[model samples]
Target chain A: MPVIGGLHRTLKGKAALFILLLSVIGLGTLAAMFLRTQREMLAEFEAERMQIVEHFVVGTLKPVMLTGHADLMSGIMASLHSAPGVQSLAIVRTNGIEAFTDDATMKKVNDRLGENRFSRILKEPVQIVPAGDPMLKRAVESGKSDFVRRDVAGDGTVTSLMYPIANEEPCHACHGDDHKVRGVLVATFGLSASEAGTLQSMFWFSGIAFVLLLLTAALTYLFIVRIMAGRVSNIVDQVNRIVEEDRFDKRIVIDADDEVGQLAISFNHFISSVEIYRIEEGREKERLEQTVFERTRELREKNDFIESDLKLARRIQQNLMPEKFPTPPEADFHAAYLPCLHIGGDYYDVFEMPNRHVGVFMADASGHGSSAALLVSIVKAIVSTAGKDISSPSYVVQIINNTLAKLTPDDSFVTLFYGVINLANGKMSYSLAGHPPPMVYNRDSGELQYLQTNGSLVGVFDFDRFEDSEYIFQHGDRLLVFTDGLVEAMGEDGKMFGRERLAELFKDARYERPDAMTRHLLDSLASYTGGAALADDVTLLVVDYKKG
Target chain B: MKITMRVAGDVTILDMIGNMKSPADLEDFSGAVNAELDQNHLKLLLNFKDVGFVNSSGLGRLVLAAKKIGDKSGHLKVVNLAPDLDELFTFTRLKEKIGVFKAEDEALRSFQ
Candidate 1:
């Protein structure tokens, strides 16, 4: 469907409508042809009636009046009156009975001769007569002759003609009056229009027949089109559904040898092809899956060397942690880290400072594995130098950023939760830079609370300020620090093991020991993954404070 | 496959004269006989006289038609079936579904 000036009209729909309109035009043309033929027939009927009446008027009345004999009309009347074919005939005088010059009319001058039907019509304006009606006043006037109109008779329609009698030389002499005009002869022409009635009947019958034909054609068209459209549309719908849903479980049932049956037969062939395609598709899917499995097994076999390399690297990274925790005594040195992968970029070190405060520094470099480990190594070197007197973790992070800001690529950053706990007074200072804050597991309240002290990612801008926050650690409170890799591990359904799920997973956890707790949490995550491939590294650290 | 049938009053002789690969031919023959039987209320003597094979679709069609005949308060008797066809018919258990006879006369007599 296309919108043209906001009106949606398609060429195919317009073409179909045009075809239907052409059919209607053809039907209308048929009707017009029928009406035209009927009009010709009516005209022919009227002309034939007029011609017959003109024959009588010219052959009988005109000659009689030319002979100047009144007896001539009466003789012709006598012969034509008794004829059964002639319905009625009357000769009316222009003045009175004395004006009837015909001899046959003279014998019954006072008698009502052939005047019964003529005068019986109460409305004298339009009437039916065989030898014309008495209303043919033209027959009395200046010899005007004509057939009357085709009008309603007792049974059907009829026509009449007037045999006009003029006041000629002989008729004028008989009058012998000083006035020029004399009474004229009148001949009634009554033509029962049975032929025209029959013609009219044929016209109406044909019209009705055509109407019936049109109705039948329309009805049959509608019926056949309905059934055919239903069947075809049903097949089309089924085919569409089959294509959409990719199913070939049903077949069309058509028994006839019509086009629709042929279509169904072809459709069955199409369905057979579809069935073959679906089976082939199933086989293809299975083949592809087998190939993928084989390839995966091969890849995993080759990956053993890489895993060993990563394990070696992890041992090297772990060996770098503080050994005995007695560099500067009377301060707690505790940390925990859970890496998502066999290796990760989350590393922390707590060393005793000369000021009796433990220097705790945690860093999460960008990404995982060897690249992140390289950057973490750089950060570790910078921090190990700064850890001597720089107990404020935020300033330490700022100095690391000033050193590494030129090394990072575009959109590359990391987050860290760094804190130095003052074992003397239990005052801890920390800075967070876009990292999930350390979860303080309160043994007193049996709740986990996150401490918020914010800083930006290191290695971003050289002059950026890093805010430092300090708080006193409670004896029973446990702090937990983790990298995003732990919370961002994906499940089979594309959902990440987000912070909320991690919290829920840890809601009833009581490993009691830092190493066991960290190991348990990491093992629980690996189990939740169900041997699925990991896309990110996992790293966490847990810290439990005991009164010194 | 095409089917042939001849109706003689209360007895309708049906010939499954062609390959009934889909059982549709059998069903068509049976349905024709049953329609006549229902319309005329005649006892049906259906002669499976010529059917040589039947497929699942064909067998299904026949089963459904026979069930329809039974629902219409009528009995159908099948006869003149070849041994192979009879084996196929027995596979569908048409004898258990309706009534099967070995001879045409017996099938006709079952109409009583």
Candidate 2:
């Protein structure tokens, strides 16, 4: 179903509708008041016409009746009846007798005579009949002069005036003085043409006024729509354009100091503010981007410098380890070094000492990476210089521990295992400083022995003592010396590659050559740890004695 | 790892929970111990009953922590170690450097 909404949907439509409605209500009220006033004025004019008619009839009839001139009275009444708008004029007797009148009254009197010889013989005898008009009878009985009424009779209005003829002193000559009223002079006047003209004129005037009011309303509606709605709509369109295009630079142009102009001014202020914010935001974004770019460039340069420095440090640490071991005729030596990071703390070296003894050293600093590598470097310098002068392994370890304790920080320490094998006697004397014990595997007996010696962590205390334990290397005996990294390596199940597992591997790989056995140990470790990255540096040194 | 420290008499008891396995865990543990040392709380007792595991790096951190405490002339002790952890301490011979107790009260008394 379609709805008939009022004209308030659009600003222009609503304005025009309000204007038209107000004009119609105002004009309608004014027209109603005008019609009411015109009706009152017409009624007053009709009443005045009745008064004049009554005065004229009473003035003309009173003189004639007092003169006792019935003929002149009858002639005057007959002339009045024939005058314009006059219907009838007659003198009606109070005792049901009508005296005097025009042709219509004479005909009524003749009809009342009805062949009566005495009524015909009387010369100008007054004929009596019952009073028919109630107002005339009332006027005669009351002796009141002015009595009038109006009756509508088929397209005409008949105004009747009753003027009572009182019994004056002159009338006592012919009549008795006891009578209060003698007769009623009744005048019936028709107002068909004049009243019709007045009504017609009133209708024409009202129609013209209504048309003029409609014209005024229409003109007012157009003027209001043009002056107010059009400007307001233009402002609205400008605002919509600004919003739709996101062009905060645009503004509404208002020329008047009206409410709409104030609205446009506020809108322009808001748009200007938005435009300023947008520019500021753009500048902020650019500044942020520039700052990020500069920071990123600086970070890249620093990273490049640090990377090259670390590479150099790694090279130096690698050089600290022995590249070639001194192969004594009694022993064959092979080792594997796996550092978990770029540089590590585990180090091993094989060198010849005095008395044709082969010295083997393996050490692990506290942690991995550059700091640990640096600690190991200090240990390497001390050991390489001190090993030449000190023949006894225990004495050399004691000197290195004391030197490290003085030089290193309190939290930094190294666990070292140093051993020297005398080629002439097949006796290997070793010292352990908080390091994992070395394991010796006998190929002939199929037995494994761990060189377990109690020692405090080196570099932690200057007074810490390391005991030298001697092991006789039998023929076909294989010795494994390694850092704790090897045994402490963890598998996925959180279990370490413990000493038992390493001893088992040592026993199993006793028959292989030294190099092949080291490879076997590493492969076993890889399999145990599921080939994951080693958590620490693993350094293993295997020395196999074929003949001692 | 979560570490909480409380003072009992002259002893600062550090209650440790969770595994100290990753480098971050080791750093957190060492940092906490160092912070306690910085405050001159030398007599430290580490309660490890709730600690599930300690990797090789974590052990190295513990060694470094013990050394740091010792260097400051502070006494550090560990208590309530799990079975594997106890074996690790014995195997690594860290028990020689730091006292290991089976109970918190014993470790605290040892501090005195």
Candidate 3:
């Protein structure tokens, strides 16, 4: 899960990088140590070989010098010259001259032995040891062998040994025994190394280190990548599969008890929790759905019952209206009622009154629905009973108002225009109570007049007075009285059909029969409103007086 | 419709905006009136300058508000009625029960 330098690297990649880094550091350290150890061992081997050669030269030269085998000293020089690491060899006398170069001493020793073995003839060049050389002085004075090592140009190193031959009793047999030291043997050994050889060794060491590093890396890959990372990858694949398939029931397989195995176990525990949650969520969803379905069913049943009751109420309210208006030869009547709901607040009725008069009643109670229907029902009852006996329309309305004021609530009231028309004399007495003025159109003159009056709404104040306004009904005169809902019906544009439009429609339909005029007006209303549902109860009544 | 209430002297003025055509509008108008009356600030004046229309239901609610104020031994008045609503008040004879004034000061003075 760790990010390096804004890049997301997997666990295996980090492991491989870590192992490679360690291997590189280890390889470098091992190479340096191997190089240092190689150089040290070479130095030690060269020093040991130089010491052996020094001892060999001293031991071989002692017997030969004692036996007066001076020619054998040339053999010794030849042997030292033919040696592998030997550069040059010389025998220094007491006076720092080559011992064999003193021909007098050599002839004395050789004539005493009767041989030409001590011949003074020089076969090779002499190598002079530097006069002030520290090893030479030390070896000559102490009568011991000493060596000094120095780096020579281009040929590696040269080790020079000064071996002092002591003036012993045996060596004094030929020469005078006056001196403590006889001569020193100086030999230089070359520890030479070729560039090709160094390169070969270096190449071998590098190759071995490289092979060892490769082997370690291969094992690391096998263990980390193949075993550890492989299991982790398997766990990742399993998790991905579970997510893609949406199967929380499946789990990662546990292969070992290592870290990766523990990770798989943790993942499996998480999956189990998810699976349990999924099951519980499914059950909760089912329970919620079932509860909602049951509640909806119960609500629907209640709504259906209420709808049925409302339909029954509508039928009863419709029955309360005059199904057939009084068909007198003196006048013709037509009415249309459209409720905003199943029942309406607007009511109208046409029936015969006393003295050859026709009674016309239309009322709109305030507010709507069942409350308005109840108020309207009370008005209908009052009118059919008390109105039948009262000769004055104003007196009848006063009675209705007093009765309603006692029965209805303080906030509730009704607007009604009631009229009693004398079919015999064309005298119509009407009272407008908190209602919109109805239009009276003269079909003969084509003149329109609104029957306006100032009267308060019914049932609000029992002390309020009602007055009668009279309009003479003549031949070819039509009256259209309606509730406010007729004028206040809204169109799609939020404008009402309005009193102006209603009056215009009344004038236009002056020539039509009462029934046809009402239908035409309602059709125009439906058209103006785009046949949308009404927001209020609309009640329209048309009375045409066609006198014979 | 939204009703904004302000106090002018002893009278609580309710500024009725928008046409009181919907049932919600009726409730808002009645609620504002009832709330003022409940607080015993009963000398109320309804400012009807912005009211465009009032259907019968809205008229009923207004009547209910007036009756409520009247029953509380307080006065309710209206001012700045639109032309049509003034005519409505005239014919319906609501002007007889509640005072209709052309200006706020006239209605507020009538409260005394």
**lDDT over C-alpha atoms for residue B59 of model 2:** 70
List ranges where model 3 is wrong by over 4 Å.
Answer: A1-227, A240-262, A474-476, A546-548, B17-23, B49-53
Q: Residue pairs in steric clash, candidate 3?
A: none
| Each candidate: RMSD | 35.9, 12.4, 12.0
Model 2 docking tier (incorrect/acceptable/medium/high): acceptable
Q: What is the DockQ score of candidate 1, to 2 decimals?
A: 0.00
Best by lDDT: 3
Q: Fnat of each prediction?
A: 0.00, 0.21, 0.67
Better of 1 and 3 by DockQ: 3
DockQ class, candidate 1: incorrect
Worst 10 residues of 1 chain A by lDDT: A117-126
Q: What is the lDDT of candidate 2?
A: 0.76
* Tens-digit lDDT track of model 2 for A141-210: 6788654556453223456666777888876654457668877776776567656567747665885678
Fnat for model 1?
A: 0.00
Give all candidates' CA lDDT scores.
0.61, 0.76, 0.81
